[model samples]
Target: MMTSKNLLELFTQTRSDSEKICQPLQTEDYVVQPIVDVSPPKWHLGHTTWFFEEFLLAPNFPGYQRFHEQYAYVFNSYYESIGKRVVRTDRGNLSRPSVQEVYEYRKHVTKLMQELISKHWNKDWNPVLEIGIHHEKQHQELLLTDIKYILGNNPLQPIYGAVSNEVLIENSEREFIEIKDGIYHIGHNSESFCYDNELPRHRVFLEPYAISSTLVTNGEWLEFMDDGGYSNTLLWHTEGWDWVKKNDIISPMYWFKNENGIWSQYLLSGSQAIDPKAAVTHISYYEAFAYAQWKGLRLPTEFEWEVAQSKINHGNRWEWTESAYLPYPNYQKPDGALGEYNGKFMVNQKVLRGSSIATPANHARLTYRNFFHAPLRWQFTSLRLAKSL
Candidate 1:
């Protein structure tokens, strides 16, 4: 548990970090949403501020006045319980709230939050405040990735910052660490902050298996592509095959072959040659599954990944799991608006274990369950291979 003063310091830093992420962007970059899955950068800023204002400042702070009455309807995300707001796809259409205006809104809410935490520190305020901070951290990751999508998709291929997306692999050798079959306890067992989905640590049975010691690399994926991995229907799930054919996905997102046929990828810094040894990223779960199938291997179940996590190197990218996003035994959803956070989205999504390059610091844990629909590849998602003994 953090002291209110410590949390307040962190809150101040976290709020500033979000703005720092957007500092490299031109005003026009903040409002474009290329796809439905990605939110505008300005929207992320306002939405995170709206979270603090709606959940903490308004409810807990005595005589707290809203910064703007209409701001709630403009920034409200997927919370049905929170009343009507901008539709998901139309988020980019909200040009009325200028980028400067969104920043002002953030400044307004952040000042009130600081005052609330400094003057009247409550024991109960700790949890909600912590949630708000972590919630902003989550948005911080999204803000960076969304920025990449916006710039990467543009024909000009503008650079956002001095950050590099290419991660060089120190070792190319692949090994599989074997784990014996047994009952293993999984999920978050710590006292630290975790999302509700990782709660109620529970037991799971697993068969003997071996999981990869390292993530699959761009060079390895290139072999799959060279061998017509995208064209082979036998290696893909039915829906995955349909997605491939429909979208003509010949290579991972951000990949392109120059006139000389050399592979290069767009990074936040700029376009650069693909680092063959770097861990492959921006692949959908369907693509991950197909690659695993091509190798006569399979994705590790979330349980297998958790029990064997200590034995392997991770955190380079979000490793896909064979597990579905579901509640653990005796899992209980918190009542009211917060309940809708993780519980309601549990269906039709695959579980991804570990963190990505774009993931914010201290935001991911061993038990963290990140999920997305099988076809969404805009995120910095990747895979490691596993096989039954």
Candidate 2:
């Protein structure tokens, strides 16, 4: 249990971090959603604030006035039990509730949250408050990705900002970290913070497998493309092949050939020559799988990935796995609206392990399971190779 003072400090820092990430955006930059996969920056701001208001404030704080009563209809994402909400696809289309109003909404919720935490501590509400902070951090990542898409796709290809001071130096070389075949315990066994999906720690058997020590890089992907990886349908799943043909995809998102026949990738810091050393990102599950197949290797199963996690380098990109996003044995959703968070999204998605550069500090864990539909790759998704020995 967190003390009142500790919780208040955490709340303040997490809330400030969200705003810090949004500081680079211009007013107009907050409202445009270039693609359905990306929500407008303003919606993320409002929705995260609404999370605390709906879940914590209304239930706990007496006489808590809603900043905007109708905001719930626009911000409640995929919570079927939480009354009606704006459809996911239509979020970008909204221009009302102006950006300023959303900031005001955030301020209102933050003030109430401060009041709640400043009072004597309630052990019961502490966990919910922690979850809300982490939830906002998750949106912080989405905000960066959505902003990348919005800016990267424009004809002008504007840079959102300069690269952070801490540069990501590439791994010196890739190696295969060997994991011996055995029964292994997986999932969250720690008493610390973890999502429900990572709970109910379970056991699984695995064959001896070797996972790459580092992520596949842009230069490596260039080899696959040079060898006609995309045009070769046999290297891809049937549905993936259909998706490729449908979308006319040839390379990773944000990559293009230059006038000198060189390739470069567009990023928040603007277009730069594809770095051979840095991890390749913005790839779909299909693309990751296809790349593995092209190399006569495979993506690791989630269990295998977990077992080999500490043995390899990670936290640079979300790595696609061969595992489907599913419930563990004896999994149970928490009661009420919190239950709706991860349980409902279990079907028809692939699991990606590890955090990305865009992930917030202390937001991801080794057991964290990030999921997305196989065809969507707008996030900072990447891959590695594994093989049964």
Candidate 3:
């Protein structure tokens, strides 16, 4: 129901915000991919631009010519229907395009998009444009988190900007809020924009349970570590135990102890002592499950999280849920290349509820379903404990 002019404004703002996130990085910082999980900043810039061009302008715009022929293969990410693309691990190796050139490509695509929205506006075009806007917003969060990973892993530990790593500490004492057994309707029900994964709202029956009123804090996580939480095999799943021994895992990502045996974490602002009052972050589902097991509790199922969300204060971190990423009942993927977005990756992934500090403004919704593999810890993820009655 958004006007063309409003959509245009939103599109412009989303594009500008992405560039702003990279302003603090130097030329050298744009190309390094320290891990396979993290994409280079330069690649994020180009891939998002390619998304708009490939899906919108190329097919619909009048006589819209590509900025570069090879750019498609260079920037197309995981779209099998879009022909060959650069391998995921080799994104950082693509130094030919240069940062300046990538910016130029963005400018080219953005200008045409503006014209498309303003001059030849169509009411039917709103859905795809909205998706493009939100898709870029998604990349905006990844931009910050990936940049943090790039700089945090550097030997010099360079500062990116004035971003905060502290969680907004709630004043209330922690307690569990009980929910009675009942059927709850879940998924996006409003007319506003949402990803395809959140569509086709469905009903779920949840058992009586109690969920924590607050997230687990750094102090609590420290207690787990001091009590040998990492070394205890009984606290972890079999595969999680193998991952711990294989990687020599000790603490959450970006955490390190000084020579004096003091714990500190690297933030975008700089390295600082860990704030015990802040919520714990940068943990994987395996670690979250292990921590809950240590405390004789379990993670809430996605249904429970959604139904009890009104009572809990979330959005500080992406809370891990005891649910797998799967389609809703009668869920049908959108036709064509757009279908490739969420339907293809429904296997072997855990669902994460809530948003995080790095999540873009207005992007998180109560029905939004974020998912990642069990061992991946690069994002700002944490957990809240739950128990069955």
Most lDDT-accurate candidate: 3
Residue 225 miss distance in model 2 (angstroms): 0.4
Candidate 1 lDDT, 16-135, residue by residue in tens: 999999999999999999999899999999999999999998998899899889989999998899998999999989897899998899989999899999997697878888888998
Full-model lDDT, candidate 3: 0.92
What are the root-mean-square deviations of the candidates from the true structure over C-alphas? 1.1, 1.4, 1.0
Lowest summed-lDDT stretch of 10 residues in model 3?
A: 163-172
- TM-score for predicted model 2 compared with the true structure: 0.97
lDDT of 3 by residue, 1-389 (tens): 78999899989999999999999989999999988989999999999999999988998899999999999999999999989999999998998799999999999999999999999878897888888888898999889999999999998999887875445566779999999998889999998889999989989888899999999999999999999999999999999999999999999999999767899988888888888888888998999999999999999999999999999998878999999999999999999888998999999999999988888886899999999999998889999999999
Residue 33, model 2: lDDT of 78
TM-score against truth, every candidate: 0.98, 0.97, 0.98
In model 1, how large is the Cα lDDT of residue 32? 97
Worst lDDT run of 10 residues, candidate 2, spans 163-172
**Candidate 1 residue-pair clash tally:** 0
CA lDDT, candidate 2, residue 94: 83
Better of 2 and 3 by TM-score: 3
CA lDDT scores, all candidates in order: 0.90, 0.88, 0.92
